[model samples]
Target: MGKFDDLPETRRKGLEKMEEVYGFDMSDGEGDFFRYTADHLFADIWNRPGLSNRDRRLFLIGMLVGQRANDVLGIQVPAALKNGELDEDALRELVILACHYDGWPNGSRMNAVVEDAIGKAKRAAGS
Candidate 1:
């Protein structure tokens, strides 16, 4: 059976949505981990109890910042915007916070990905 054969339609769509935000597309042929991460990361881990989606996005952004994962943080900027948990201001704050912990090198280009996100947001908001 395919890795995603057992997933619900909504769950599959969530992964597809996130993948699109991440500049990826999916296929049953992708790989077990890819399918699994899509289901778990977007549909499971992101949908679990307690926190709102925005709250979760914030935490995720902060986690990337703390770990010096500027690249992931950059991609996440658009994802967070899609999830409605962030705006340019919030993303900038996350990068600023990272500078104190992870240093400026990573924090610097953080805006590159984030800028893309901001531009997308502006486009989406019709600014």
Candidate 2:
């Protein structure tokens, strides 16, 4: 089977768009894991089978929620929305679920972050 490089031109363009909209450096910042994440996080893991990009975003949000990464969610939740992969309610569910795992305090913070992300995305889309 083909890897990420074998995807359609449109998909590749989407990936490039993600880099721009999400402000990620596809190039590694002079470290092994950094390069690995940059190269494979999208090109490999995100290109997996049996799941849509929306599914990938859902999983990513779940992981981020469980990890209590609200601080970074400011960027990432909006990034997921920019990828056309997340909706407001689904994002809210991620935050709500986080309360069960990461505690209500962290969930509250994530909720705020997700709200900001949704607002930012809506504004960017001029909606």
Candidate 3:
């Protein structure tokens, strides 16, 4: 059997959820960080029923901006766009609102990241 065949149910669900959330395959991830990320973050946290994926993405975007987590935003912004969690206009508006609350420096950085992600997505889609 392959490595994933015997994974605990949570881990398997996490892997599936991670792919859905990130718009990419997550089956090859390794190490403890990857395990916890897939198992706990994705499976338990993201899959929680109260919030829709788009709602979660909006909250996460604000949190990332507040924390000035540009690198993670690079990953998340594109994934949000790709997964239809947020469109380019909505992302731009989100940055505007986030900037007011999180400050311009972080918002500025996030704005650039969001624009870049949108550009890349548009190009990839041949739009």
Best by lDDT: 3
Candidate 1, residue 93: CA error in Å? 1.9
lDDT of 2: 0.68
State every prediction's TM-score relative to the real structure.
0.66, 0.65, 0.89
Sliding window of 10 residues with minimal summed lDDT for model 1: 20-29
Among these predicted structures, which one has the highest TM-score? 3
User: lDDT tens string, model 1, 6-95?
Assistant: 767756755665665454556543577776776667667766789876676677777776676866776777877766667678777877
lDDT of 3 by residue, 1-127 (tens): 6455678888888988888899987774789998889889998999999999889988888888888889998988999999988888899998898889888888889899999998898799995
How many backbone clashes can be found in candidate 3?
0
Tally clashing residue pairs in candidate 2: 0
In candidate 1, position 105 carries an lDDT of 81
The best-first sequence of candidates by lDDT reads 3, 1, 2
How badly does each model clash, as a count of residue pairs? 0, 0, 0
In candidate 3, what residue range of length 10 has the lowest lDDT sum?
1-10
**Candidate 2 lDDT trough over 10 residues, lowest sum:** 21-30
